[model samples]
Target: MEYFLGVDGGATSTALALCDREGRVLGIGHGGPSNHILAPGGEERARSAVLTALNGALAGAGLESPAFEAAHFGMTGISRDSEPARAFAAVVAPLLTARIVRIESDASVALAGALACRPGVVVIAGTGSVSLGRDPLGREARAGGWGYLFGDEGSGFALGLGGVRAALHAHDGTGPSTVLETEIPRRFGRSLGEIPLLFYEGRVQRPEIAALASAVTAAAAAADPVAVSLVNTGAEGLAAIAAAVVRRLTWPDGTAAVAPVGGVFRAGSVILAPLKAAIAARAPGAVLVPPRFEPAVGALLLAMQAAGVAHSPERLALLAATWELRSRT
Candidate 1:
């Protein structure tokens, strides 16, 4: 039986899936944070995460180490053919014997998963944010994936940082009074003054700060004007990212799917309503859609493609069913 492997390595965790040519998923495994760029230990950290997940998946599949027909690793902070990507690829390459191996940005797999590789845009908002799209003609474009240091506009980190700043501003009388002043301390168990020290001292990291986005959205839900304004601003920023990609790609039918993937979207209509409106205004041709499959399955689809395999409807249905069943446990 010809086997395939697909991995989705993100800022928070890594997930790997093993499947066969017939689209039957044998097993799924998971590991910790592996975003090589942001996560300490860099390529070594990422390599450990991938191997841990791969081993778990293989064990679940009841198989010893075996060569795969094709494998794809969709990783955060990785770009096609980039130096970091190449370095990480080299670290893992020796462990797997595959006819084809691909290392690409997590956004690439998210887009493929969101649209089932059909052609559309995907905006991923986690600790970071980026937008990527592919035209029907196979032309591709991307915008806004500069990472935390540059701009992660609509990302969880941005919203969370806004909350922290709002708290600081309120405390110092520089901004309007908002619940975030109390809310921030309640969440972090620290006064506003200590928040900056959390980062400066390395006691907290990007993901920790990004976690505060939920508090901001919760405040928005409670009708805090300041929080509401931040939400809207963040939504507009994300829409702008999507708008940039939409402009670069031509959809002959004058329409395209723009899927928003990640934790920030969990705010539901609180964030989605503004995001949808902003996207509609910026690119009338774009339609916001939920992803058809998660990124690991997207990576699997890409793996199959790299092996020169056609993904028929029957195969997709099989993959969907099996993945759903496996994920339930």
Candidate 2:
């Protein structure tokens, strides 16, 4: 049986998969950060991530020279117009005799994954936020994802910064008294006064700040009003992104299926419950649905399609079942 490859080059790390013609997963691999804009070493690091992952997958499955018929790479930080995808394709060209190679933004793949390649909307809220959707006619639209400097509302970075700002506000006696005043310090194991020093020395970076999102969620869970409000606002921001994309697409069903994916979604009911309500309010008939698969699996589905492999409903189900089985082991 022929095998295909799929790579999810995410902001934090890279994931690669090998699958059979039947869509059953054969092996999986992982590597370091691949985001071109945010990750260090840019194209070189991206190339290394992909190559190492492919090698790891092959080694894990005890294969010395696995052949790929086609491959797809779904990556972050590169837009549809970015040449990095082409560069990545070039990097892999010599490694395999694949007939087809395709690369796209992580947002596009997330949408494809959320809807199982069906036309629908997906909002990704991890360290960043973006929403993308496809119409039945293959047309697509996007909202947010402008990056942290511009947009990225409802993101972990945003939530973390918000928590920090709220702490400062309370410290200055300008905001409501909340647990964040102490929680922030306790979470970092630093005195509140030392936060500025940490930032000044560049000791606190995006990933470090983004980690504060967990503290915010914990505070909200403990019934802190300010934390609750922040969570609600973030959920609304995420909903707005989904609403904007849904507005641009022509849904075959009166309702568009909306799905949320990413680490931020791990906030659970603290985000999803309100996010569902907010999207429903703005985008009439928008239905929040469970994502069909992870981004890596979505890339696999797209790779199979690129190779002209038939992925009927039954086949997709088989693919999902196969992934479940492999993941458990």
Candidate 3:
């Protein structure tokens, strides 16, 4: 009757799932923004989100308090070595009744989630982008996770920026005409001229800008040349990240399993077409895979691994599918 908990404390929201020793998800819970790098009270916010979601999942599982055998916290904004990650570990360890509490970066959990703890590579493109890889011997490596300031080249934010730039160029008659000139204004419900002021004033936030990536994907689908170019370039950037990780690892067989995740990938063929092409060109012999589960379920697998318990990948995959279906409700 051992229970395990997996929490994904994200920048936009937090989700948790409670599962049994067999990886059967018993309950799911969610809460608001929990990215701890936002400062002011980022740690507190993350803690609250984790606690709230934990209680909700516990209640759903018909429990009074957390009495789990192990738990994994996939926290956003703090790497395993960062002070905040350490502080968070201290803050949360005492709160939960679980005998083992492990905290790690969201990217690490994403890789764990995608491969079910098997050695593999994962490229994540949400508000930001990062690629991580693990070898069979447990050696881990990463590339392109520098954030939106200068990196995140393949992220939603980067795609949106390209879209905005192309739209402005088209409006000024400096770039080839594309659907973005009209579509951008429509997506934002504002005049195209306002974008300049918004950018100059720093009012255009990352998420708002990243939202434009969808417009890029949509226009590319419509055969807008400028939009199509951005998608291709973005895909190349993402693929480069994966290739970089692949090069660093020692894969003697040269057949590496790669997975891409996040909203940027939601465009399906819009992004994947170019991404696969570039990965083939750069990281030859890499095999791409769709993720088996979301990060929360990956956290559960990590918890099980920490407790020295062997998990059936087939069972964990099934449990992840079931949890995902329940999450949609």
Task: List the pairs of residues colliding in candidate 1.
Answer: none
Off by over 4 Å in 3: 90-95, 199-204
**If ranked by lDDT, best first, what sequence of candidates would result?**
1, 3, 2
Model 3, 188-265: lDDT tens digits are 888888986887798876778898999999999989889899999999999999999988897877789999988899
Question: Model 2 segments beyond 4 Å from truth?
Answer: 37-40, 94-97
The C-alpha RMSD in Å for every predicted model, in order, reads 1.6, 2.1, 2.1
Clashes of each: 0, 0, 0
Candidate topping lDDT: 1
- What is the lDDT of every predicted structure here? 0.90, 0.84, 0.85
TM values, all candidates: 0.95, 0.92, 0.92
| Tens-place lDDT digits, model 2, residues 82-168 | 677666666667766677788788887787777889988899987889999988878999999988769988998889888998999
**Which candidate leads the pack in TM-score?**
1
Q: In model 3, how large is the Cα lDDT of residue 145?
A: 82
Worst lDDT run of 10 residues, candidate 3, spans 31-40
Candidate 1 lDDT, tens digit per residue, 1-329?
89999988888888899899988888899988788653457867887888899888888889898889999989988889998788878878877788889999888888888889999999888788999999999999999988786889989999999999998999999999999999988998887799899899999888989999999999999999999999999999999999899999999999989999888998899999999999999999999998888889999999999998899998899999999988877
How far residue 74's Cα lies from its native spot in candidate 3, in Å, is 1.8
